[model samples]
Target: MNRDNEKRVTPNLDENELMNLMVDGIRKDGFKNPIETTPAEQPENKKPVIREQNRTERISPTEYEEIFFKEVKSTARHGKSAYIDPVHHKKLTRIVQVIGDDNITIYAYLYNLLEHHFREFEELIKEIYEEKHKPLF
Candidate 1:
């Protein structure tokens, strides 16, 4: 049998048919390439993580109540406009209507939120702002 003279018979099966044949043969031989994990082999009680996934410390409802009714002490006021998401705006409006008296408008609610945020991150915010701040000579 001369190697050069012998014509190799190429199988006429399509790619999918060829793959199926190869896979069937491999499976029959008890050779698991990827090693698929069956449901029965896996732990039945395995649970996904359900802990507090908040990025910041979880604030109590009392804290929120305090912030919601906190009096604005700063006399310095600036005229500015804010574009809030429609859904969030609606929610805020509802909250203000429910929790607010004559003193707490949407403006006040947002200002208090900003004030709380600034107070919490005052040092970090100051540092970052100072780094980027330029004084006109």
Candidate 2:
């Protein structure tokens, strides 16, 4: 058979075509390809099925308590948290700028200011307190 009349086939063929050649005992330049059983011939794999996440999962009571009360604890000891007007907030920020300490925080400046005006600040905070917590005499 003339090479020109015969159709050309490359060594790198598709997986199915290669399998078919192996079954047919065809080799390319003495390089034999291994025969792989068809996927249908193998048993179906029992893959672990994954379910969608429970979007409406409820938080546990302990988890809720931890998150809700974590920050609301004694502000006097931990530090007071106030939602002041933006203008006052900016003024407080300016005080830290004037102090010229790069490491100083707004809390330190605010605490220092409160300590300076303890009489006034004490009265203001006391007025908002639910009940006058008196120490046992």
Candidate 3:
């Protein structure tokens, strides 16, 4: 390995912009790791915090009309099956068909529904789970 000829390239970006870029990259790529910042390092503007909030919470969709009718692509990941009432299943399928796009999958809509439910009841679910479960230690 030659030690002398390597040229280090550093991007001429503001520290705040660099951090924002990293955060955006992580979000776009669906990386789960949290980016931690001390109070002093935190940006003066609250825009980043608002941007990082859950999409459903930030949008605060008032009705199914806002959330369910949007066009979305199918997820690449495999999903586990949970049986529901046949009526419910048929209703979901009908909703997708009504969208007039055969390419959309029922699972995406179902996933969005579950996401909304979980976000709405997140605190209660956490509290109940903590109360019910005892540590094995």
Tens-digit lDDT track of model 3 for 1-137: 35544665665757765676675664544444458778788778733443334655556434554575555565636667788799998988887787625545677777777777898789978998999999999
Using TM-score as the measure, what is the rank order of every candidate, best first?
1, 3, 2
lDDT (C-alpha, whole model) for all candidates: 0.70, 0.56, 0.67
Candidate 2: stretches off by over 4 Å: 1-77, 119-137
- The model with the greatest TM-score is 1
Q: Between the candidate structures 2 and 3, which one is better when assessed by lDDT?
A: 3
1 versus 2: better TM-score goes to: 1
- Give each model a TM-score: 0.45, 0.29, 0.45
Query: In candidate 3, where is summed lDDT lowest over 10 consecutive residues?
Result: 46-55
Instruction: Output the lDDT of residue 120, model 1.
Output: 77
lDDT (tens digit, per residue) of candidate 1 on 1-137: 67755777765656765576675564544443445567677566843335535634677767886976676654325646668999999999888878775457777788888888788779978997998999987
lDDT for model 3, on a 0 to 1 scale? 0.67
